[model samples]
Target chain A: MKEPGLEQPGIAVEVAVPVRRTPLDEISRVKMLACQAALGAVIALAWQAVSGRLVDDYFISNPLAIGRRLVAWIGDGTIFVHLWATLYATIVGFVIGSLAGVVLGVWLGVSRFAARLTNPYLLALNALPKVALAPLFVLWFGIGIESKIALAAVLVTFLVFLNTFAGVREVDRDLIDCARLMKASRAQVLSKIVIPSAASWVFAGLKTAVPYALIGVVLGEMIAANRGLGYLVQFSGAQFDTAGVFAVLAVIAVVAMLLNWLVEIWQERMERWRIVSR
Target chain B: MIELKNVSKRFRKGDEVVEAVGGIELGIRRREIVAVIGPSGCGKSTLLNMIAGLYPPSGGRVIYNGKVIDDVNTSVAYMTQKDNLLPWRTVRDNVALPLEIAGLRRAEREERADRVLEHVGLTGFEKRYSSELSGGMRKRACLARMLLQGAESLLLDEPFAALDAQLKLVMHGLLLRLASEASQTVVLVTHDLMEAVTLADRVVVCTHRPAMIALEQAIDLPRPRDVINVRFTNRFRELYDMIWDCLRLEYHEELI
Candidate 1:
């Protein structure tokens, strides 16, 4: 019996070489962060210096006054109720729409006849502006969370649907043939190959839909709702309270940042297995 | 045994009707290694695809074990030049794919996948995704996946085209060794003349578009060939010159 050498060429040389010897990349990252902080500080100071000087503070509220209003909102604890209401609508809509979209996308993606028959109609429906339909949704579902959820779900469903359809279509034919040769059934192929292949596309669409979902919620609230960030903004604007408007805007900004941060973490975890580093 | 009975294939794109393979009649006995050499886009893969039942021949049928194949042939396993491992799956999971299809339990499939990975010298790479591995490692993982299927017939399309010289020789040795264990019938399509002579029992040179069997040459070299040194032998050189003569002659006519 002959013994195998297993002597791989050049791979050993590659392993011997260090990945990144210098700290230049790390230093550059720190420099970028410091630059952003400095920019924010300058803007804040400039706003404070000019408060009630060139323009009346009533028209353009100062950062400090907005902060004070935010502190006051926190003290009364009513802010939590509004925040929860908005959050509840967004979550319910996102879940229902994303689930329905992926399921239908996969079904239509697999069937050429079904995809062809309904593609144009789906596109036409997606093309319709959500704002134009907001009033109808309110009238149909009433001025409650149901209307808000409907608005958000409609906005989210299409993005996920299109992405998933393309993803399923983009799956390599050779891979499917390879599996078929292995004697995999149709159900097995769909479950094990097609669905897993479409996952990244679904995730991408979900990420893009986040801002739009929030938009749908805020739009519904501004049109007829009793609570939410959008309603708060509309109420303050009506009363000519600029500081109150900025405070509500700040809360919305914070919530958006938190959602985006969570998505960033999720995206990192989902795509960590990617081999694009080389 | 697998036999192609005057098989032919044609593809249509708008007004363009292209004939890929024309009257290809061939036979591959069980456990025989038949190397097919052809020019680029010469329907070598098309012929293999027909035999695998992925593409229906326009004219004739393919016979496997004296039975005509009209649908996908599960008795065969195929490997193409491109590695098609699922990007989302780890190496172990990819290797265990066929087992999953066979409805093997998780622990059993994992155990089987690990053993095969060990055979392919990919033990530490079980957890790594296909995107993380080097080209050679990815190829090995693909081979491991094929190995787990336990299919008796294989249709290989330029399977080792991406490998370096030394690695190709090692893989060729491993392939021959593993092939003989299960009496696997391998129909390999490669551009390398030396590879054909060294690894295959018989070599078939295919003509340019509308491919037909231009020349069929048998390699009478003894078993267990040393892939690195076989090209030095007079018989190997003679076989190489003969096949190259046919290829060069056909290519010369294509210049017109």
Candidate 2:
């Protein structure tokens, strides 16, 4: 026979423990930033010390020389013109390509027949090295920003498209059925359920596509262009100006990081409900 | 308001056809709380899915309000075994989802969601995401969402099967109070016999695979009953034992 209790039968009395709520804090942001800055300083100091002694300055330009080149370019406003050109192509191409990819991917994702029909063609296109099409894009769109934009758009499209397709396909079936039971229209299901559910994946695709967009634009500019960072790189390489090449490369790295950071911020804002702090 | 006429479901897994639920005939009256109790994997959930019209029955028809359910039945709210709450939405937003789908105004939706969240004792946790909630709290949120629908019927598939024993007791009290107050038709599918006896007006026991009705026993316990002390009563134990005896027979048959 089990002893009767207020809440449960034959259960031992549970000790009451008061829970203390405390705010969770990870490694301070300022500390992390300081560490990153220190690491960068250490690398730069090592390079500056070894330059012209252990290795020729022509091979790997000294950080001081690269900094001087960047300062000179900034003083003459040479950096801003080329920076703006590259930024414009990368941003515009990325937005257009991502939007188009989302539409196509979502459409194909929802339609099994359409996805199956275009599977082989999409796979073949994706498998093809997009960098190889740089010359062709320049020939078609010409040496202006159009060629760079077109090349970037093409590269971003395939990457975003594949991710969006997978994301849409990966949406939880149970969530869809739950919505359907709540009298959700097909459009409602897609907008409210499918799209939001696949948002993380879309963000992932966008994040990866950012660098690829820059790569595509730079490649196109390298193949044929009169302005932009790629042209600067090629011109400096031809002149054997290692410091100029390094400065331009450094700027490109910063731009890529800035674009990636923007995507991350957008993802965090949009997916506020997904708390990764477990 | 729900009727299943010879309901059957068979799933084709690769080349083999597995019959989940055999022909089942069951009619549930309006405002009745019916609990279908059976062994695990006895096709109990398949029956509820038919009522909710997730998928059409392989053999028979499921009738809701005198009309056969062919498409997804939006009239009845269903809470599957999984909470199925959208991970990207807060407790308030998740509770307001059905209303949002129905094109309800934001003010009206939030007001109703607030009220329902309070009713489910999730008053201050409205902004918390599903990932942050404990299992019991998530279940309550799901229940609040279901209640906010204001549907005439609710089909719950093992709704509280995942909760701890102490939490389960509390949830039972909460559910009994709500169900009695609202008087909505509820079809609860659970393998827990005690739970079936506690909240259900009638308990329907099902057999093994290709589940058929083995026993349908009415719980004659008085209303306004305390879920905690009710289990200690002689009548509750008798009902539990009776259902267990029938369920034990099914298990023995499965072994043989």
Best by lDDT: 2
Against the hidden reference, what TM-scores do the models get? 0.87, 0.87
Collision count of model 1: 0
Cα lDDT of model 1 by residue, B1-256, tens digit: 9999999999997999999999999998999999999887889999889889987899988999898988889999888778989988899999999999999999999999999899878999899988888898898899889988899898888888878888788889888888898889999998888888999999999998889999999999888888877889998889899899998876766677
Off by over 4 Å in 1: A1-27, A275-278, B13-16, B220-248, B251-256
Candidate 2 per-residue lDDT, tens place, B11-119, comes to 9999999999999999999988999988898999889888888899999889999999999998899988889999888989999999999999999999999998887
Report the lDDT tens digits of candidate 1 across residue range A1-278: 21235445643322233466666555787798998899999998898878799778888889999988888888998778788888889888888878878988899899999999998998789888966789999999988899999998988888888888989998888889888999999999998889888888888888888777888988898999899888888889999999999888888888877777777788777766653434
Docking class of 1: acceptable
lDDT minimum window of 10 residues, candidate 1 chain A: A9-18
lDDT of 2 at B250: 88
- Candidate 2 lDDT, tens digit per residue, A14-67? 655566555333557888798889999999999999999999998998999999
Q: Report every candidate's CA lDDT.
A: 0.87, 0.90
